[model samples]
Target chain A: MDIIKKLEWRYAVKKFNADKMLTEEKLEKLKQAFNLTATSYGLQPIKLLVVQNKELQKELVKFSYGQKQVAQASHVLVICIEKQIDQKFIHDYFARVQQIRNTSDEILDPFKGALVESFSKKEREEVRVWATNQAYLALGTLLTVCALEEVDACPMEGFQPTSYDELLGLDKLKLTSVLVLPVGYRSTDDMFATLKKVRRDLNESIIHIP
Target chain B: MDIIKKLEWRYAVKKFNADKMLTEEKLEKLKQAFNLTATSYGLQPIKLLVVQNKELQKELVKFSYGQKQVAQASHVLVICIEKQIDQKFIHDYFARVQQIRNTSDEILDPFKGALVESFSKKEREEVRVWATNQAYLALGTLLTVCALEEVDACPMEGFQPTSYDELLGLDKLKLTSVLVLPVGYRSTDDMFATLKKVRRDLNESIIHIP
Candidate 1:
């Protein structure tokens, strides 16, 4: 299907049919898409937690401000960032780069050293902001992927992160949830499914500079 | 092509073929894709500046930290956010919503009033951050669109936004550049094209909790 058609067919699905579940194959595709999302400096500080347990999803709905889509959807994908983005994290990325690309250390050392030094000097909040930005990129990628796969999804940020971290045990993993996406099949009676998408006109949303 | 395959085929092109250009039809698809990107509250707070002028792109190269790809691509897409996201912006969105959906004012007024009140209380910086996050979503959507269209793209944050704003005279439009993307065909000499993508294994990036 054409991408534009796929995009037009997608929306922030308000209601999901709990009886319809995503196949394992489809969920695997989403995992690959999220991993491939581009991040600044390719540090990839984001991690995705795929929650398929209905009880946990029910528990999460409270933190999500009573958005029942969290519990009704086939799965809730939580995009999280490492609690600390330190020198060791940067080193690990470059080491993986070396192992994968077989690039010489001479070619990698300068950029690696520079990034490690630069990141080490940044404030914790600044790092968190940077990591959160990457999570948004992943969210964006997964949203598109879900649309193409005919998976209904709602990208949400209205949740209380501290509560989610506590319930999901993210703190122990040194991670903090930044974004949540619930994906499944949309309910047939979802009123939002039939509403025309409200978007700005092209001229209002785009500028051409020749 | 499968979405996963298309994603695997995509990489940040280091060198764009200056002689190759995206067809007008393809560019139109990108504009539509950007407009259709999901944003928080569906406010559609982002704008895309499509630059095809070689001279302007050449000028942008310096500000882009000497990244020549900014100058060589068929077009440079600058994603910007409204300088001020005020109550009026919220009202305008609802006005459009009313025009398109013909939903009763009774259904819209309460949500509109709440949004206006909530946004009125936010700091200017807070609103800017929220709007910028939407721009990242558009960026992510466009990245997927570009990949599916067989267009080579480099999603860049290396540029100096203030310089871009001044050069493009964006402040006059009440817009601030938040992200930049260079899109076209990749040059064969771009060695990065052939290297394996460096990504974490699925187990490292995704945690499945059943």
Candidate 2:
């Protein structure tokens, strides 16, 4: 299908086929898509956790407010933000940019210096909020990719993040979960798959200044 | 090109071909894509301002930290959040849902009531923050769609919101700009277009639990 038709086919799957599993090939594409997502200042402060262990998935359903898709989907994707985005994070990002671009420090320093200075003035909460927004960006990218790839996914935010962090040991890894997506095949019995997608009319939601 | 290659070809464009413009057909697809984007609880408290007027675009460049893409692109898409999302907003969403899906209030009222209760307890800033995250989701969706459609776009956050709100009269419309995207063809003379996309290795960014 073309991109638009594929997008039309996409919805938040309510019932994932428990027997279905995403191939390693599909998993790899998702990882690449997540890595390729555009982030603020290209800082890339997010990490993705691909959980396929059934027992762990079952445990997470409770943290997800009893959403069984967490347990039934072939894989649970967790999008996370760095616990702290300090000067070191900024320095390291520039290092990656230089390594990839072969750019000189003279050109990179002014840009990096500005970012470092800007981040320094931000409180931790400010930085976290900023990073969380980037996490949402990643979520948006994955949802679209999943649709194009014909992967059924339910993008979720109703989960308890503190419970997830403690259960997944994300705190030790200096990460915090902000979004959860269950990916697999939609069950034939899932009625939501056939339901009409509700949306505001384009004219109602968009303003044109000509 | 396939979607992956298309994604690899994407970048935050710097300079746009000032004379080039997005055709109505392409703009319509983008509008549909924006409307089709999966918002939180389907309460799309987001408005897309499609600015195609050249003089207005040029005048707003200063507010965007002097970024010229704001002036040179075909359309400057201002993604804004509703200034307030109250119980009435929740009620209106369910009404739309009922209109589209013919779903009865017997099924929708509990969900609507929960949302109303949730928002009633939140401070205006909190609701604004929630709505702002949805805007980022829209940004991510648009970036991916633009890439797939081979449209050049620059997603930006450096613009002064207060300035944009005042200049664009967004506040009068009960909206606040959260993100800016300039969409058009990239300039042949622009150097940033050729820069290799920088990203961390998948191993460094993703964790897999089997």
Docking class of 2: high
Give me the displacement of residue B110 in model 2, in angstroms.
1.4
The residue-by-residue lDDT of candidate 2 on A96-117, one tens digit each, is 9999999999999999999899
Tens digits of per-residue lDDT, candidate 1, B1-210, equal 888888989999999899999999999999999999999999988899999999999999999999999999999999999997888889999999999999999999999999999898999988888888888888889998898899999999888999999999999999999999999999999999999999998899998878
Error of 2 at B191 (Å): 0.9
How many pairs collide in each candidate, listed in order? 0, 0
Off-target runs (Cα >4 Å) in candidate 2 are none
TM-score of chain A of 1: 0.99
Pairs with steric clashes in candidate 2: none
- Residue B160's C-alpha lDDT in candidate 2? 98
Provide the global lDDT of candidate 2 against the true structure.
0.92
Each candidate: RMSD: 0.7, 1.0
Deviation from native of the Cα of residue A128 in model 2, angstroms: 0.4
Q: What is candidate 1's local distance difference test score?
A: 0.93
Report lDDT per candidate.
Answer: 0.93, 0.92
